[model samples]
Target: MSIAPNQCTVFVQVWVDVNALAQGSTRGCYAVSNRSQQSSGEGSANLHTNVITSSNVCWTVLPIDPQYTGDFSITNVGAESGWEQPPAPVAGMPNVFTGKLTQSTVGGSVNSNIQFSFDGDNQITVTLPVTITPVTQ
Candidate 1:
């Protein structure tokens, strides 16, 4: 698999379908002005459903409290990593390298940074960036 010079689109769909507490005929929907970690309200009631980060996307979301020492085993080799699949549909394939992403929450502010690089790139630095998304629930 090969990543071109530009292509890192991380689309996180928060809570656009959830209906919040109704005041009248107007049903509540996710508004662009809402920004809060505890926005997942209705999900806790129906379907016992909770937001689970879709790991299929390239990033992982860390909480806004405490801190984290990012660590995970690599799940693929460079050739068949992201979009490319291994020649054989074998299980337990590993990533080329491992990394640590650090995040800390202070004064109600969330700060996080995750870094990953392609060791093969000699001329330039290759990396995958992490994105945080807030949604209504």
Candidate 2:
């Protein structure tokens, strides 16, 4: 089940909200794995090899809270691995961006909305619900 150009191959959404961390809010980690190679469990019996065209792949993140304003930095966690950061626009296969949220400080709970756009208008938004577990130190 190979995906043709302008075709939707796989759609994924995930929620992550870590309570505790080793290096406060300045240090943490997040990771995105490879998309499954199997096609839809139903329909076609043939297995689809996941291939990101790079040109068609993109990942974007935005804070759900309009008032919340802080440094929302992302880093490439997978270096030795083949996985890398998403390329800037004007570039093609869909790409995946994965990294931990880095900020000077974060208080209370917050939410982040992630969107993966493909085939122009076709897209998906993955929600990340963040909850900072209070620590007594």
lDDT of 1 by residue, 101-124 (tens): 112122121111122222221211
Residue pairs with clashing backbones, model 1: 1-79, 74-95, 75-95, 76-94, 76-95
Lowest lDDT 10-mer window, candidate 2?
A: 39-48
Clash count, one per candidate: 5, 11
Return the lDDT, model 1, position 98: 20
lDDT of 2 by residue, 1-137 (tens): 22232332233222122221211221222322124432221111111223332212223232333543332322221122222222222123233343222221343211222332211122222222222111221
Per-candidate RMSD vs. true structure? 18.7, 17.4
Strongest candidate by lDDT = 2
Give the residue spans of candidate 2 off by over 4 A. 1-56, 83-137
To one decimal, what is the Cα RMSD in angstroms of model 2 from the true structure?
Answer: 17.4
RMSD of 1: 18.7
